[model samples]
Target: MFDGIKILNADADIQKLMYSSVLDWNSVVNDGTGEVVGRTAEYNNLTLTIKEETSLVKVTGSLHKYANAGIHNADDFTPERLAGVLDSIQKLGIGINSALNNLEFGVNIETPFPPAKLLERLICHQRREFTRHVSKGFEYYQCEHERQFVVKIYDKGRQFGLRSNLLRFEIKVLTMQVLHKKGIGIYTLSDLLNQKLYPKIGNLLIQCFNEILFDEPTIDTTNLSKKDSDLLINGRNHKFWRPFSESNFETKQKYDTARKMRYRQEKRFRQMIDSSPTAERLHKLAAELIATKWEILSNPIVPLLHYTLNVEMGQSIIPTAKECPITGIDISDQKGSSRYLSERTLKSDPELLKSLPVTIGQQRRRKHHHPEEYYVAHNIRNAASNPRNSIKRRIERAVKNTPLFQADEVIRLTDEQKKILQSVPSNVPRNKKPR
Candidate 1:
């Protein structure tokens, strides 16, 4: 989950990336797979893409230029900064990438109420209003703006939903994990969504719900009345909103000192519990467990970064391809890419990572020729163009074969060898035929 975050700074002119300019190049959109990838990318070497699956847009590439256009000199690598920047993008109205342009928010709430019943209370009491119910817990309301609006409650997992175009602000949550996405990727909406709509909705739902699920109820099970719930929702204290808002790294920094103090207290509490634990009864365990769980649960597991990984470094090379014997169109990989040098040296020596990719990525093809044919062709070309290298090679061969000096019979030498040896510099040693 969210182990590392890499920020992309644009190399190209920022004016060129204002809107859909980056989207113009070799682009392909696959609605079936929910993906759009573009290439020449102008800004970076390769254009980027937006991948949608599980109802969340995963953006790759292009972000560097996009980020560069929006801001000035400030580091934006942490989760909080990442969230705020993404939010700012939609607010600025430069969300050209369709997949990420649609603003969405994801919330994980631990509540006792089922989604269907909770939606019922919210609608019935008019705590908030909705236009109509679509499918299971999926509701639509007349948007403040005339864009596609969605209010969905997930029945599948722990009272959470991942949807698009629900809100009209941005916070791009890109954990930018090359491999996995658990608590990773862009998992945020605008802070406007948080400060206004999200809290009120969550407050209403949590306030109106029961103490436990309907299927498994305790002896003293109870639900909140509308009047009492409303009072609690509008109260000064914010038990629900505080934890939710402070989950990302940026927000957490605001209360850094307080969180550190709480962390210390919790650490001591855990130690105390481990040493003096005599909880045989359910009540005792419950009393001890809830506080610890609440503390741990509120803190986000991963802290994201806006650190930059250069284009050549972040991208993986294409594997070697082999054409089919029959069709020739069907290509399969024969050998995989070898990135041993790039991966190992990147940590200690970043400048070294620049060269190899340019070498491999920008390769050219020429007319094929046989080994002997190329040798002869190259030699012919060399002699016809500039005989300098050819003459040097021939001279070296002649010199090695017949040295300037020779010992045939006694200490006598051939006239040719003698003249050659004499012409040589006095200080320069001449090789002789060994006896």
Candidate 2:
């Protein structure tokens, strides 16, 4: 339902309101950038999204989503929630214009002005317009009039055509077209947000469109009513408004053939009447004729250009949750169910409960461990591990155990122990004796 239409600019206040409505199962937040994105959990049909940026807050959820949410009332508008959100924003002083979707209407038209003649006067591009529907032999040029409206005109042949669009005497103008015509001087949307600029730009465009279509001398047909002109000009609907009927006629002949037959029959019938003796009585029949063309086309052709203009009107907002209330429930900045640690969720095992703190404390201390405890544990482990030193110690122990050293009550170092200790120097001796 959303047709790529959105409010590009929004105040932070409006964004804050949307943030509350977003569901939090898998919500994401970035404190560094102050960006928050969330979708309404309950309003699943319509994924209401909210974005909080540095300059502006953006809230986007088209009315189509709400209509699909099954909240329709038989007699009321199909998607009533859209109306509610519109009301909520309006209360915030944001113009309704900010949220309206774009509208487009067809504007194919005809005038005394041919595309070539119009091209001479206006800015337009050459086109190979398909004219097969109306008749095989017609050419036209399509171009922009005054660098404004999209205008098309038939050139080579006559016999109303199947133009790109059906003909209307009045031209159509779109909202964006109006803005383009206005160019640089018009007030910006930021001004509209501040309520300083006019919000009814669509209405303004409608006026400009009417002037370009109706008041323009080139398009104005002297006596034709717009409605009559439209019908008369768009007479090329051969298939839908078929020339032949089911009750009569051979195969469905071409539109030109049917037309030629009517003209010929009228001519033969007139010849028959004139061939009678009454032909000599024609000298007696005479009457006055005024400007018949002017008389018939006398009606003013009010150009009825189709316009589906965007309506934008925003109001002041207090910038809080109370500003725009949602139908579901009050939204909290933090989304999710309550984190209540009930008895069922608590640790039930006694040993696990007692050790939980110690486990947590140890894990916590790793980040901020005591320096003394670290080195004390490090010093207890022997790192040097000299192989020859170990052997010398083992030999000394064996010598002390012998009767030579243990002869007395006190175990003293014997000459054999000293010799065993001195046998291997701290520096390993490289010299070897061959036995």
Candidate number of the best TM-score: 2
Worst 10 residues of 1 by lDDT: 212-221
- The candidate that achieves the highest lDDT relative to the unseen native structure: 2
Candidate 1's displacement at residue 23, Å, is 3.4
Q: Give the TM-score of candidate 1.
A: 0.22
Off by over 4 Å in 2: 1-4, 14-48, 51-55, 61-85, 90-435
Q: What's the TM-score of every candidate structure?
A: 0.22, 0.22
In TM-score terms, candidate 2 sits at 0.22
Global lDDT of each model?
A: 0.29, 0.30
For model 1, how big is the CA root-mean-square deviation? 31.6
